[model samples]
Target: MADDRFSMGLFDARIKDQRHQVFKVLGMYFVLMTVAIWGLLSLFWGSTYQLESYFPSVKVYVYDFDSVATPNAVLGPAVVRYLQSTLSSPVHLGIIVRDPAGKTFDDVASEIVGEKAWGAVVINANATSNFEAAMAGTGGLLDGQWAPKGAISLVVAGARWYQVVLEYLLPYLGMYVETPVLEASHQASASFLSTATPATLGELTSAQQAALGTPFAYQEVDLRPILPGQWAGAAPLEAGLIYYIIFAFHIALFFFFSRLPLQGMTKKHGIKIRWIHVCLLRIVPVLFAYFILSLAYTLINKAFLLPTDGNGYASFGPQAGFMVLWMLDWIALASLGLAMEAMLTLLTLKFFPLFLITWILSNITSSFFPATLAPKIFRYGYMMPFWHCTTATKHIMWGTRNRLGLNFGVLLGWCGVSLVTICLFELMWRRIEERKERQESAKDVEGQGAHK
Candidate 1:
């Protein structure tokens, strides 16, 4: 904390112990940046291009059967072609054959629902005019049985994709009857209104008549925006993948810089500086360098799947912000490594344990695979700096607000902890160097006294 030490410590050390091949370090960093950034971007870009071209999403299936209709007896294929032509080319429907002899109408209906087919049309043998009258009008009889005069029964499957398609296309795609669905009559104001009315036919214990009311309401749910654009697979994964690789390299650079110089490399002027300062001092340049590479790849390789509203500047800006925040994980990891290195440097015992922690943290947090692929409670590194940060990358790239707050908080916390750790380690490292000087000076004095 002395004024002279403040002004001269790192500066005097840099000038005195400067390497003849400091040129070599710059060269190594260039080779590293070029190879690491170029190779990853190339491989990822190609993979993304091929996958997008090969796969088309959203497949639809339809089944239409007519036993009673004298006209257009084979209606299934025509219906399939019509539906396919109505929707986009990628949205396709295949016909499923249903023989009147093989299964009953209801049995085939159940099969349509069970096979995960989107919907089925059934045209029974009794094509009576009273079918519509049976369906409406106080449950009137059509050939002595009940249903709308022209209504045909449709059994439809409801799943994520099926429902998403059905919500919009169902109204326009299905077979046309005057009534979209058959409505049953029920009594409104009476004792049966609460529960005494039949909830199901099998559960009915008493007979009851009820008035039926019908006012049609329809629904359609679509997740895409008004101006739909698609992004998927490797394109979306690129930002995080680069962040991981750069972060890993940064970690290795930190450790390598902190390593002791080759033996017998001491300077002539009695000035000694440990390797920790080399790593810490270069943080600014290293960050700027990594950011420049990231910006280059993002702008050049449009192949990376980014989910965006397509503001080029917004994508570039947020991506840069994400990279800076992502870098914090490794930077914090390096600081923790430096603190451990300071302890190991003083001990002069086994260094393997220190190296082990450094190596493991680098690999495990690198996002070659994400932390979430395992259970939430991973024992190996549940507490480390990058664990939560990689998770945040997924949320951020998803262009959702889902864990943005949590990810930012945890990463910022790691940075806070790492800063405190570096300050303490710097103080400890300086004391160790000063103590070594005192011991060497004492030995020299003793030698002089002996010679006298």
Candidate 2:
């Protein structure tokens, strides 16, 4: 009876001590969480506002082929002048003028493709002749021979946001180039018709000038359109929501498992199971929660459920292919969360700091802009799991036939690597526990020997 009372007293004391430790850790967790919330809000909002004051610099290579002959000067110089004038204030242009007399369109386009420049402008050789043809209303057929040709061709890197900015500015730039060309065309036509009737020429010239204010013609081709449709067509926020949703679920699951009680499987029931098995078992319940939440969210949104056309240009749909992709993505998320929780088990209190680091890094990821344009450190953010999830989700929803395979490869790779890491961590933890148990047994044996 006395031995039983002693063992009961010791068990009660141990339980009390454990309870105390749990309360202490919980208190610290609450305090840290409060601080983290405040700090995250301030940091995220502050950086966004600060980044607004600066404009990304774009480099444009301009090759002018317009002949500077008399009667009508080349419009190549006029195109450059207009580009320089309008593509400013919001976008800084680094215009590199190549001698049109020597360089061909292929050379400049190749250079832009090589990343030597963001975009290129090639003005054809017959700009002067074409302007004269327009003035004469000859439909580019002057003196019985068609004018050699005059057109501006733009070749730009399509994936970068800064390059897109330059492309958008082109139409506005037509305002500058078109006004001067029309004025010159009007003067030439009025002069040619003056001998017939001055009053009639004046009226015709005024009317024609007003109607043909914008006569310059240009064509643009993006080197990396990636899809059939314009990259600009995808809303940045809609695409970014993929990252946000996965991130929320990943972090939440990480915390859930970190604080979960393992007594039932570990000791109370005396079940014989490996830690890896426990980790794998978690997926069943997690998948249930994920499916329920995802279904509810999808229903509420309705936008995601709409069938996509999957047109040659832009893919649109919520079809079976998308469902399979989403399922794989969910599995990857589960593996990611489990791996993080398992790895951090030994350093439980550090989860908050690690979470903060991940949150900040993800916020700075190049979602709306070109990854190459971001800071050197932020360029590495592409490797973050959330970034891959965002890319895959966006491509599945709206992108053309590009990068879907790569995205799937990356996600599945992360899952395998993370699971392997967790197994290694489990082995290490088991070894540590075994050593401690052996030492405690030795201590107990020695104490009993002394008592005997």
Candidate 3:
């Protein structure tokens, strides 16, 4: 009995030593592999979507309803030219002038929505006459006062890209219009100071007041609105919800995957279960957590950002679609993660590979900016699950256009690939483990012989 107890103790010690050796080798290999991959990715795909790295360029369609003799023709061409010159390289203009006056705002809007141009500048037929009237202090709320009326209409796409374009263009255009008006006002003021009369003094002051700002009062029209009216004010909440939903899945993934090894080890000894069944069992909790979190997130967003007095879930088509897409996305990502973890464990039992993989995927996902804006070298990011996931999420929440079918295809493709890879690697691992066990048996016999 004492001999059997001693042998059991020795066997346990050997197993512990083998585990220590496995971990030591895996730790070193994981570190080296992670560093090598990270270095290569950074070298090839340098930071691509930085605002400071490049200036923003916009496509503009200009429609002039005024004839060559009118101020619209002169001012419209001049404004377009100024815009072309003012925006520096990497931020240059692509301006097209449409001649036909029949093109309506809807035509321009459709084009903008279709990604033809960032904005359209529409010069009304009455623009020149209106400008003249405003300058003459006639046909406006200004009975005797001089308040300029806007003649041109600025129709801009309401996407994030167009917002950036407008931020660069609008100020410069305003300054261009105001500069001439101010110069004329200054000249008039100087002229009137020398020849002082009651009428002249009033004229001088009126001219100065009118020229203090832009003479043109352009009306801004939104081509695409995320929410009805201006939702730019709620940008923070919108963005927060996106990040929250994404990271919530990520967090759940991290928590559940960490216990996967323990789950495998603690399987009932007498019961025989298929590997796929085991995988499905593990996935159930992740799905439950994901659904609950998704529901909570939707409730919060509706309560604050998209609040309606009635039942929010009644008109929850988009939200339901978003949830289904999110579920597929997380599942694909989780499957991919599992496959990677299994492959890495076969090579090295350390958890460092999981971290490395997660970190790399997070970087390339391009959640902060549109993947289109990313560098050409980083175009592989388009195939990543999270990129499509975030994109589909944006489309659902903010009403942005996206290829939902394509996104779904990409995610499912990843899942199929991962499951296949995991199966192959797991089979390979079983063979490798068998070989190692046989080798260990041989060593044990040799050690016994040496002891004898």
Q: Native-vs-model 3 lDDT?
A: 0.53
Candidate 3 lDDT over 286-328, as tens digits, reads: 5565556556555554555542211222234655754554464
Candidate 3: give the clashing pairs.
150-217
Clashing pairs in 2: 308-316, 308-317
RMSD of each: 18.5, 8.5, 7.9
Which candidate number has the best TM-score? 3
Estimate, for each residue in 244-303, the C-alpha lDDT of model 1 and write its tens digit: 444545543554455445222554455655546643553444445445554554443334
lDDT string for model 2 (123-233, tens) is: 666665665555455544445433322356667745433334454535433444465455444554454556536564455453244323433456666554535443433
TM-score attained by model 1: 0.37
**Superposition error at 39 for model 3 (Å):** 3.7
> Each model's C-alpha lDDT?
0.40, 0.53, 0.53
- Error of model 1, residue 406, in angstroms: 2.8
Rank candidates, TM-score, best first: 3, 2, 1
Scored by lDDT, model 2 comes in at 0.53
